[model samples]
Target: MSALSPSAQRVQAVLDGFGLGHRVVEHEGSTRTSEEAAASVGCDVAQIAKSLIFRGKDSGRPILVIASGVNRVDEKAVGRLIGEKIERADPEFVRASTGYAIGGVPPVGHAVPPLVLIDADLMALPMLWAAAGTPNAVFRLTPEELSRLTGGRIEAVRKG
Candidate 1:
């Protein structure tokens, strides 16, 4: 069998754990940005879900915000929802928390259970794609399914 990238492997493990049926697509080059990833996946940029990790106010746990490509996460709103201040997680903190690189963090399968919040805008898209534990790998699914698969709370996590 072929070896899988750490991110891909992690994503696969998560999917398997949840008994989700998904198809993984791998691209030839890096899809580090939403634009690049959308082009590689042949999908609209808005359909791409960006998995972002942020440090919680308590400084002990992390929050994972999955926002749509066309939207920006509202830090204040997220902070209020989580009942704590929030800041973007640094690269070291991100890797330590998710076990994946900055651009490759998946919506699921983190070393710890992050307080997951999904952007409501993503539900507008019929099909959405999220990083599959790797920058070059992605999987297609409905926003609702994605939310359920990740145990994410669907909310207004972003701003236009």
Candidate 2:
């Protein structure tokens, strides 16, 4: 495996601080989308944990949604749950808030602590694959561990 990039290293440091021994796996290229990650990592699409970022329109704060790769987050539902209006955040906003870029944002490391919400659907899976800061690196974690590590509230946020 190649050396972990600075971004990945930051993610590793955060994971370590959490006392979780999850190992980051660096790949040949960026897994920009859940479908791409699923194909590259040989996992079911549903097992890919997409760390989606949104901006709370009312509060002007970042909102992190850790949803199943195959499921689209329902913005309306999320807004209701969090008691704020929300919209999909732009790349610049995401970068400013999360430090990591869109495709490579990790669930644990962020520039600021956003209101994190984990899809309850993700909890049904045994393991989840998520980006490890860099676009080319990733890591695996159990749903329960992910919830605990991020202090995410589990909710049904998928769009029908």
* Best of the candidates, TM-score: 2
TM values, all candidates: 0.93, 0.97
lDDT of 1 by residue, 104-153 (tens): 88888888889999999998889998888777888888998888887888
Q: For candidate 2, what is the lDDT?
A: 0.92
Backbone clashes, each candidate: 1, 0
Which residue window of length 10 is worst by lDDT in model 2?
A: 23-32
**Judged by lDDT, which candidate is best?**
2
Which residue pairs overlap in candidate 2's backbone?
A: none
